[model samples]
Target: MERFIETLMYRSRWLLAPIYLGLSLAVLALGIMFFRELFHLIVEIPTIAEANMVLMVLSLIDLAMVGGLLVMVMMSGYENFVSQLDIAEDEEKLNWLGKMDSSSLKAKIAASIVAISSIHLLKVFMGVKNYDDMQLMWYVLIHMTFVASAFAMGYLDKITKH
Candidate 1:
């Protein structure tokens, strides 16, 4: 019975394999969404509608940034936690893959969030005529909160690593 249990534990490491692969599938879904957004933007280009075009452009940028963030996290997290990706010697490889451990990954994620937030804030500012001053202030505050939280998290993580 003990040997059987040991075998189970040994094989369970591979169970993580599937979970990591699922992350790739999620990445695929994000790609689909990204392209859909892109096509929508293209379709709307000729309408010359009253909608805030600048804000809409910022929104598209924000979505692309988010897609990038998802790809980084999904691929890097899988590589860090599950297995090293076997990129062939002659093939192009991700420069930062395997190099970014969880700590670095957190920092990258934080920075990405800040970038995405900045885009969102810009969108809000561009649409300022439609939004009240209070709503704009809240948007700015929420983004600042996210910035502060990310800073604190990176600092604490750094302290622990040493």
Candidate 2:
């Protein structure tokens, strides 16, 4: 019975496989949204005000960053937690694939979050008139929190490695 239970427990890791697969759907949805935004930007290019054009481009960049984040999480999370991917040796592959452990993946994710937040904050500031002062303050504070958290995580990782 003990041996059987151990086998069951180990196999339970497979449960996460479906969850990781679901992230692909999220990536697909994000891609659709990105193209939709791009279409809108292209269509409005003729009459878009300079500021609004900048804002729209920023929005597209933000969406792209989010899409990248999702893909990184989905691929790295699966690689770390589930079975290794079986890829052909001759095929073009990501340089970091199969190399990122959970710790590095976490750091990368935190850094990506900070970058996304920065872009978002810039977008908010670009259209400052649309937001109340209090709302703008909160946005900056929240972005600062993300920055601090990422820094602390990197520091901890460095110290732990030593």
Candidate 3:
């Protein structure tokens, strides 16, 4: 009975499989939104200011970073918690697949967040005339928080490795 219970407990990890699959749908949705924005940018190119165009580009970049983060977390989290993914040798494969452990995944996530925050802060700065000083200060503070968190996480990871 004890052995059976342990086996059942281990198999329960499969419950997360559906959640990871759901992230794939999210990736698809983001892809659609990205292309939609791209089309809009193209159509408004002549009418949009250069700064506005830059801001749009930054927004797209932010989306891409977030999409990447979601994919990484979904794939790595599933593999680490559920089961190994078997792929044929001849098939195309991701170099980092099966390589990122939970710690690495956390670091990657933190780094991605910092990158997204940096892009957002840049956009805010670019549109400084549209925002009050307090708002701009808050944006900078938020970005700094992300930067500090990433740095601390990296430091902790390094210490743990040693």
Candidate 4:
């Protein structure tokens, strides 16, 4: 019975496979939204003010960063938690695909979150009139918190590795 239970527990890792596939679907949705935003930007380019154009471009960048984060998380989480992906040697492959372990993936995620937050904060600053002073303060505070957390995590990870 003990041996059977161990086998069951080990095989349960497959349960996460579906969840990772869901993340791919999310990436697809993000792609659709990105193209939708791009279409809007292109359509409005002639009449759009320079500030508004900048804000729109920033928004697109934010979406792209988010999409990249999602892909990274999905692929790395799958590889770390589930079975290794089988890829042909002749096909195009991501350089970091099989190389990222969970620790490195976490660090990358933290850094990506900070970057995404920075872009968001920039967008908010570009349209400062839309937000009050309190909101602006909260945005900066929240972004700072992300920065601090990522830094602390990296520091701890480094110390732990030594």
Q: Which one wins on lDDT?
A: 4
Report the candidate with higher TM-score, 3 versus 4.
Answer: 4
* lDDT tens per residue, model 4, 1-162: 999999999999999999999999999999999999999999999999999999999989999999999999998898899988888999988999999999899899999999999999999999899999999999999999999999999999999999
Backbone steric clashes in candidate 2, count: 0
> Tens-digit lDDT track for model 3 on 41-134?
9999999999999999998998898899999989899889998889899999899999999999999999999999989888988988999989
* Residue 143 CA displacement from its true place in model 1, Å: 0.6
lDDT tens digits by residue: candidate 2, 8-97:
988888898899889889889989998999999999999999999998888898888888888888888888888788889999889898
lDDT accuracy of residue 158 in candidate 4: 99
Q: What is the C-alpha lDDT of each candidate?
A: 0.81, 0.91, 0.93, 0.95
Model 3 lDDT at residue 12: 99
Candidate 3 regions exceeding 4 Å error are: none
- Per-candidate TM-score against the hidden true structure: 0.79, 0.96, 0.95, 0.98
Q: For residues 1-162, could you state the per-residue lDDT of candidate 1 as single tens digits? A: 999999888767677777767767777776787688777778888884656566666777776778788778877887786678899999998899879888898998999999999888887776688899899889999999989989998899979989
Model 1 stretches astray by more than 4 angstroms: 1-13, 49-51
Clashing pairs for model 2 are: none
Clash list (residue pairs), candidate 4:
none
State the weakest 10-residue window (summed lDDT) of model 3.
118-127
Task: Note the clash tally of each candidate.
Answer: 0, 0, 0, 0
Per-model C-alpha RMSD: 2.9, 0.9, 1.1, 0.8
